[model samples]
Target: MSKRMNSGASQQFVIIGSGQAGGWAARTLREGGFEGRIVIVGEESHPPYERPPLSKAVLTAQKPAESCYLWSKEKLGELNIDAVQGNRATAIHRDRREVELADGSRVPYDRLLIATGARPRRLNCPGADLPGVHYLRTIEDSERIRGSLSKGGRLLVVGGGWIGLEVAASAVSMGVPVTLVEATDRLCGRSLPESLGRFFMDLHLRHGVDIQLNANLTRLEGNGRVERAVFGNGEAIEIATAVVGIGVVPNTELAADCGLPLENGIVVNESACTADPCIFAAGDVASQPSSWLNGRVRFESWKNAQDHGVLAASAMLGGDALTRDIPWFWSDQYDVNFQLLGVPSVGNQVYQKGDTSSGRFTQYFVQANRLTAVAAVNSPRDLRDAKRSMQNKSQFDTTGLVPVLTL
Candidate 1:
């Protein structure tokens, strides 16, 4: 067993939360030649694993939990990291530079990385606590959902975001009937553009997934288990399993308890450094400055988490490396792979070419005649070229660029 240290021991590096960000930070620190005492504290019993697979592959039993690992326990131990898993960090005693765990043990550190990720937001409606009500976040959650989805059951998905859409696609592929409900008029309302959102709606519709927009859930009705859902319009639908993918709430209690100023997330600079010199943050729980968005933005994507983790580790080790990577995100629904490069804003002039109906199309969002972002549907090579163009700050020739991309 890894020895637990006292509160007032010599200052070393301590990472809270063993998610992607924390795992990468620890590895990056070692790679950057930091041979000091390192401690990783996690509330989850399992080691760090890829989270994007949870909604699709793992939830549908296409992949196993071991395949999602960023680093196995043996690998982490080989790196000489003292891992304390299955225990939650109760509080942060900033005055003493110590972190209090649920088991009354404390770990002191000179530098701390709060990679404590987010949790799924729960619905306040009635019957939400039923047996069939599930939320996807951890591997265990995905396992439970996979078991519930066996033999093709009727699933009521309550959200229109990436997770909900991905799960809907997975369930439909497994021959399950999925009815997705969203409170908004369009899917991915907060992320994708309205036109793109409608395109996705059509895509899902073509895949035989029932989608309901502008529909608010009043309550989930069941007999000791989630069996049906009631909408705001008094419409009811019978369902065997209910999965909530509304969104996630950042786990910022530890940071907040230490008096860290949080706006949307733990406020961090371009280098992922927090307000205190001894503390830093990264991944979904960090609201850091973005060169692409021209402001501070919090991105909840695998790319951001992994990249920011490296940047955070570099900053913690007295290296200068600000995250300049343009935000990129991808989603797989049925046969289509949707990829987006750069930040898509409202003012961009939308340009379209090729057959979107055939699922081979790309949308170029140009702001002031300069390509700001590009959305691709099953067009990987074109998306790569578009990303390279953005990296080079090249303006798009709307007349020929679109046709060339299609070629």
Candidate 2:
């Protein structure tokens, strides 16, 4: 076993939660020429893996979970970093500069990075404790869901967001009867525009996925296992299984217990540092302040998490000051590819550059006659250009944007 401490008072870097952010931080430390005792503590038994495929390819059994791992065990060994997996960081004693583990061990550190990610929000309705009810978050969760889906049984999907829709699409492709319920008036209401939302609504409906909008699920009725769901609209539907994809709640209990100021997530400055200079945070768990968006936004996207990891690592290494790029996200549902850049808040004037009726187009959100954000469906070329335009905050001729689409 490698000694935890080296000669002299070399810096001890401890990272909690071995997700994207934590993994990146460790890698960055080595790459940045930091010769310190680096240790990563993760609660999961497996190493940090990519999560975007959880609801898509992995759930469909098209790809194995091991393929999603970003770093190999050999790679970590080569980097000379210690990864303590399957151990939870129970508490942090900032005054003593030590992190307490659930196994009754304490690791002293000179600096700490918190990368605890988010968890799927559980359904609070009655009978939510049934056996057949599932939530997608980890590889284990996805494995169980894949088994349930193999039964070729009725699937009741709760929520209309990306995860729910992606799972619904996968289940439908497998010939499983799926009924998706959303509490909102449209699908992806918080992220997508009405036109794009309607386009997806039509696409799903045409593919035999029964979608119920404005549906408030009252309870899940079953005999020790999920059997049916009763809605507030006084309608009941028999279901073999129920999958909840409502949203996520940041795993900030440790930070909150330590009296860290948390608004939606762990509050961090542009450098991804907390109020204390010795501690930092990133990924979905970090509510980083964005200078580009002119507000503090906790974005739930793969790109954001990866970007945050890089930025936080750079900041920790005392590199150039961190800068927030335009937030971006992508989703693959059925045959359509949706990409969004920047924050598309409500009341932004949307300028359509292509055919929305045909469901292949790009919509640019213009505020003050400047392209602030964009959403593209089946239009990757436009998405790339729009991303550049959004970064520059430049104006483009609407007619010209339509012609230059082959990038």
Number of clashing residue pairs in every model?
Answer: 0, 0
lDDT of 1 at 229: 92
Error of 2 at 167 (Å): 0.8
- Model 1 lDDT tens row, 86-118: 999999898899999999999998889999989
The local distance difference test score of each candidate is 0.86, 0.84
RMSD of 1: 4.5
Cα deviation of 229, candidate 2, in Å: 0.8
Please give, for residues 1-407, the per-residue lDDT of candidate 2 as tens digits: 11222222388888898877778877887777778788999999988777888888998888999877878889889988898999999999988989999999999987789999899999999999899899998888898998988876799999999999999998887789999999999999888877678888998998899999999899999888899999887899999888999999999988888878999999998888898777889899999778656778788888888888877777776666556678888988888888888877665777777786676888877767677778888999988887777767677556644432210
Model 2 residue 371 lDDT score: 75
TM-score of each: 0.94, 0.94
Model 2 / residue 251 / CA error / Å:
1.1
